[model samples]
Structure formats: C-alpha cells, structure tokens
Target: MGISVTNISKSYKNAKALQDISFEVKPNELFGIIGPDGAGKTTLFRILTTLLFPDQGTATVAGFDVVKDYKKIRNSVGYMPGKFSLYHDLTVEENLNFFATIFGTTIEENYNLIKDIYIQIEPFKDRRAGKLSGGMKQKLALSCALIHKPKVLFLDEPTTGVDPVSRKEFWEMLKRLQQKGITILVSTPYMDEAALCDRVALIQDGKILQIDTPEAIVKHYPTSLYNVRSTNMYQLITSLKTYEHHHSVYPFGEFVHYTDTRSDFNPEDLKVYLESKTLSDIQIERTEATIEDSFMELST
Candidate 1:
C-alpha cells in the first residue's frame, strides 16, 4: 500500500554511495528525505523509482518490487528528479500533453488530478519551458508528473532553485495533494523544510542519522542549547569556540548558538565573560531544540 526499503546499498567503482539504508513511507503521508549534497539522496530515490538497481537488498513502491515489477512500479509512481528533466524546447502545454499521451491517458482523463497545478501554468501554455521563470518551470514539471495520476510521487529537491515565495507556495501545493491520498517522498537539503514533513530521515555520508516526526526528532536532542548574541557577530563565534567552557558554537541566523561543556551551565556566567572580553550588547538566553539542532547533534 506504500513504500518499503530494506538494507539497500549502492556503489560506484571504489566509492560507496549508499550503505544499509532503509525506511518506510506510509500511504498518503508526506515523507521527507533530509540531507546535504553528496549524501546519496538521489541514489536512493533512483533505486526506489526503479531507474537504478541496488547492489544489495530490495525495495518496493506501491506494493511492487523494485527489481521484478519495475515496469509496473514505473507506471504506478511519478518521479520529478532534482534537475528539470522536461524538454526546454517544448511549450508548457505541449509538455503536459506529451506526458499524458505517453501514459495512454489524455489530459482530460486526469484533468482533476493535476487541475490545481495545471491552471497555474495554463496562462503560459504557449511559452517554452526553458523561457519560463524558475517557479513557473517547477509548476509545469509537477503538472506533467501528475498527468498520469500516479499512486506515489517522488520529488527530489523540488524547491532547490526557486525563490522563497515559490518555495512556500510549492509546499502548500504538496499539502493539498496529500489530502487527496497521494503518498509523497520528497528530498530537501534545507533543514527548515524538514519540519514540513509527516516524517523525515536525516541522512549524511550515505547513512541515516535518525528517522521520526520533526517534533519527535527535536525532542530527542540530548543537550541544552542557548543563543548568544553580541554587537560583533563574527568575533563572537571565534571567541566562543576558544572559550574553555563552550562545548559547541556555530552561527545560526543573526545569533550564534552555543552549548556548555560543563553540567553546571549558567547563562549569567557566559554573559559576564563576554562583557569582560569587551563584547557590548551581549545577550544570552536558553533556546528550545530545533530539527537543525537535533540534526547537527546526530550528524556529528
């Protein structure tokens, strides 16, 4: 009814791309694969989509085996790779029609399936896909992928290149699609986006660090963290790293996040030390754990 992956491994020449990776995606759930570049997210997506085979273990999508039922799996699932794989030369409408025709279904047949997305790009129906803006291009690509009304949707870093507005709009669309009972497997490098998923797998260097709901993952963070800010952001980072009592210090937005090396941590002590160091406007406050914070703890 959903996706199942177990101990899947892939290799290229002497390098290991993915090792012992496994996870399950529930039907109609928005499952996210969170990782940075070179973390094997693409390889795992390809193997599950039946575009590539694994060196070990097995996977299934929509209840079909990746190896034996590849053809059926391909027909059952829709894939939008990280790159814009659609024809740049074709007009938006042409691309949609082309994909629909190939799937043995007309646009009219699946009009309801992609209607919400297709209408947004319909105004640019005559425009070439390459000429459209990044956001517009994204909509067209998604429309074509859904033209077949696939049971499972695989999107690889779909919002990577779009603007902030487009990124927000795209996620809204995904939420709408989920209400219709389409299982979505999305991969993103942005840690903030991990919170949008029903469940996420934090991946790094071809391995999964953790898999759980964003809230659960954050709850698993083991350390008490704090936000430390001063007039000189750059200087504060270096000073905190060199500070003997600091456990970890990294720039996060306008403030620098820091953890204490000692069990008896005190915010007042850190503020006093920074003041002695001639740092003005210093503010130290306890902060709640975030998905990124948890990921940093696990990935390290």
Candidate 2:
C-alpha cells in the first residue's frame, strides 16, 4: 500500500482544520491534493509524516500504520516540507551529509537516487545554504530528502515561490523519481499543476469536493461555459452578475468565465444586454471548462 486515509479530522480550539478527510494514493502513482491556503493541506501532511497526531480517524503510509508504526513510516518515507527547513548556517555539502548521517546512510551509499538533483547543486557545494538562490535552495532541500532513497515521497507545494522555469524543471525531476518505483504524493494550490498528476483531490474549507483525473474532472463540468470580456473589466463582471440569465460568473485571467441560467441561451443576446448597460466592445465566445471552473462550481 502507498497511503490510506480514512475519516481523518483535526481541530484547533474552536476551528476544525480538517473534516472527515479520506483518500488513497496508489503505489508508484503521483497523487496531488489541490487547495488554497487554510484548506488543511499542511495539517494532513504533518499527520501522514508522523509529526502530529490527528484528533480523529486513522492513516497509514507505506503499508505501516501511522499511529502504531510511526517509527517504521518515518524511516520508509522522504518529506520535503513547504518551507525550507535546512540549516542556513551550514554549507550545502555539510547539510546534505548531516541528513544522510541521521538516516544511518552516507551520500555515496545512495548517490544514484539523488544524482540527477545533486549534480546541479554540487558546483556550489562549498557555498552556505542561506546564500543559494530560491531555485538552488529548492533543489538542495529535495536532494537532502532523497539521500536515503525513501519508498514514498511527500512534497508539500514544492513549486510554490519559484520561477516558472524552475517549477517546470522541478516537476520533471519528480517524474523521473516516479519511474524508479517511488510513490509520490504532492500538494499544490495551482490548478495547472494539478493536471500533471495522475489524479487530484480538490479541497476547500477542510472538506474534499471531488477526486478524479484532471481530464475527467473538467469533463464533469455541468454547464456550458463562455469567455466574456468588454471595455471595462470591473463593470463587465458587475453587469454579468446582475443579468437575469446568469448562472455563474468568475474572473479567469483577462476574461470572465460565465455560465447561463437558461439552457438555450444566446451570446448575441448577452452582448446586446451589455450594450444596453453602457458597456462596449463586448466579446463572448464559448470556452471549455478547466479544473478551476469545476472547483468553483463545487465550492459554490
């Protein structure tokens, strides 16, 4: 087994951080948990990594019970947290060696597993960890996590705060690791990143809305969507929400993704309506739904 979570729940004082959450990550599969901040992604990661105890439910990682076999699970998995937790005072090589030593393994013992990532930072091995660029820091953290060749890897928002080019490169590294039979579980708030995973779970306010392949999730969008834009972006949004036939209106990049309340709605009629409201240069075209669109529909 890779990971199994059943009815997991947690609370902090009066607030419930996670509410009866449950999901499975198949062995060797890249599973993603997609949600924004305060959605309980970190709480769930901490519980699975054996760093925190849940108030309810049960979980297992790498076929070992999270509560009963915490020690075994910690040894069998590698975790790269959302923030950089490595020693800033230590040199790159020094930090790497420290982590490896903790797991009773030397870098040379598992050089093959982290060679792809380590090679990129090896040139700066003499430099202090705090002096490295954001991308470099990310690579070093990942390298340290993989030093012991864990069977399961848990990356919490690995690409968050990095450049787009670096983000792309990071995902490529994860795919190569998956090829070597390491089960991966990653969490991200970016909808685009969700598509790269084999499957995803959309969560909001401590509850799971839906879980499926990205393609299947978008296909399940219940209504026809359209891209709407006009001279005034703010007014266009305001006017659409007040329209008699409007169903859902959300700002997606430069265009407003809108759905109609009527099944036989016409774009031309909407354009005419906008014109009557003093909005000009109105453009409305049918567009396909995205993961974000499906999430908005479910959360609403």
Candidate 3:
C-alpha cells in the first residue's frame, strides 16, 4: 500500500519543526527523505508512523488516517528510529522475541521476511544487544522492527554512525526487502545515499527544497560547473572568488567548484584567469553534477 502526506506540519514553542510538507510514496517504492540535521525529517517520520500528530494537514498510510486511524497505521508500519532504542541489556534473540510478542506474532512466523538480514547476525544471537558492535546492533534492531512483517517500513537514519561497509550492506538489504513488495520510506543525511532511492525530497531548515529522482535533480543544476585544483587549494579559492568574472566558488572534494559570471567563459578562459591571478599547478575541468552539488545549489 502507498503512503500520502498532504501539507503536514508541526511545531515546537517558537520554532516550526515542519513547514507544509507534502509527498507521496507509491506501493513498494523505496522513497527517501534527504536532509541534514534539524531538517524535520524525524518529525515527519514520527507523524507519518502515527507516533505524533501534525498541527496542520493530513496523512494516510495504506488508506488509514494518521490521527483517527492511528491503530491501523501503527500496525501496518515498522519503524526503525534514528536511535537504537531496543533493550540494551536484552540479547539479540530476546529483543527480536520481545517485539514479536508485542505484535502477537512469533519470530519464526516472519522468519522468511527477515531471514537474509537476520542470518548474518544469527551466530551472535546470544550476545547482549549493548555488547554488539554498531553495525551488528543496527542489524539486530532492523530484525526486531521487521519481526512483525509490516507492509511499510520507516527507517530513520538507520545507517548513521555505522561503518561504511555496514552502511552499504544495510542499503543492499533494504533493496532486497523492497523486492518483497514492501514500501520503504527512509530518512538520511548522506547525499550519496540519496541516489539509492527511487525518488528523494531534499529538505532544509524544516522546509522542502526540492523533490525529484536523483538524476532529475542533478540534471537541473544551474550554470556551467567546473572543478579547479591547484597546489595551494586554499589560496586558489580566495583568488578565484576575487576574480571579476567569478560567480560562485566552493570546495568540492580535492578541487573547488566554480562558475563564471559570463556565459562565454570557457575552459581556456578559466586557465588564463587563474594564471593571471598567479596560481600555479592549476588543473581545471568541467565536472558532472552530483546529488551534493544539486543540494548545495538548491540550499543556497
């Protein structure tokens, strides 16, 4: 079943936590909420999963109202919070069993649903949840979240603080889960991870900046982009920004991304411009727009 959120918003004392956010997730689609901390991702997830109600607008999960039909929404969605909130002292198996029992189900009943992910950590099932590594703890938490076999899974920053390998593995497992026809809505602060989703909504300061497929967002990046590297990267940034034609300059990996004021400016022009500014060992090249680049452009 699909999820739909329409103009949903929430607030704290003096600050708005979410501002007129709206989006839709198709059945079995892997949709992502991409943003940095304090972007209202957690607040939106909480509202959608029926943990909290929005001050404005409405949302439905599998055709159940978030507020009035909270029970149905709660039962239909599996939520993995940003923090690892399972019983720390409970063993992996115990945690899984606990969650299953809460839903009036057994781990074995849903074993096939999570078998691929659970088996990886099954050998350490007897280990205390607190004693497990970050990645293993994540896996165990996910296993518990899925023990009930909900139709929609909401993962809130599930890969945060884990190692790169574990993060990659977690995403792979999510793809496998998606193949089972379960809808997934995940929130992430990592730009690169945005590409993994079928569609993403980039948010900032409690507001939606843009929403589109990763490729569409990147393709919409404005201006001619170039990556310039030099021996003195810091000085190069300063000098480039001071140049008359320099439009915008920011650090991008080992190089600085820059745009020129004039549409006529080309690679050879950039080389001459840098050389005139006394920059040495300069390497300038046009570069493709990445999710991060699109985000930076939109955020500004």
Instruction: Give the whole-model CA lDDT for all candidates, comma-separated.
Output: 0.92, 0.95, 0.92
Clashes per candidate, residues 3 or more apart or on different chains: 0, 0, 0
lDDT of 1 by residue, 204-289 (tens): 98999999999999987888999889999988898888888987888899899899878889889888888788889998888998
State the TM-score for model 1. Answer: 0.97
lDDT of 3 by residue, 200-228 (tens): 99999889999899999999988889999
Residues 198-278, model 2: lDDT tens digits: 999999999999999999999999999999999899999999999999999989999999999899998999999999999
- TM-scores of the candidates in the order shown: 0.97, 0.98, 0.96
Please report the TM-score between candidate 3 and the true structure: 0.96
- Stretches of candidate 1 exceeding 4 Å from the true structure: none
Native-to-model Cα distance after best TM-score fit, residue 76 in candidate 2, in Å? 0.8
Could you tell which candidate, 1 or 2, scores higher by TM-score?
2
Full-model lDDT, candidate 3: 0.92
Best by lDDT: 2
Q: On a 0 to 100 scale, what is the lDDT of residue 195 in model 2?
A: 90
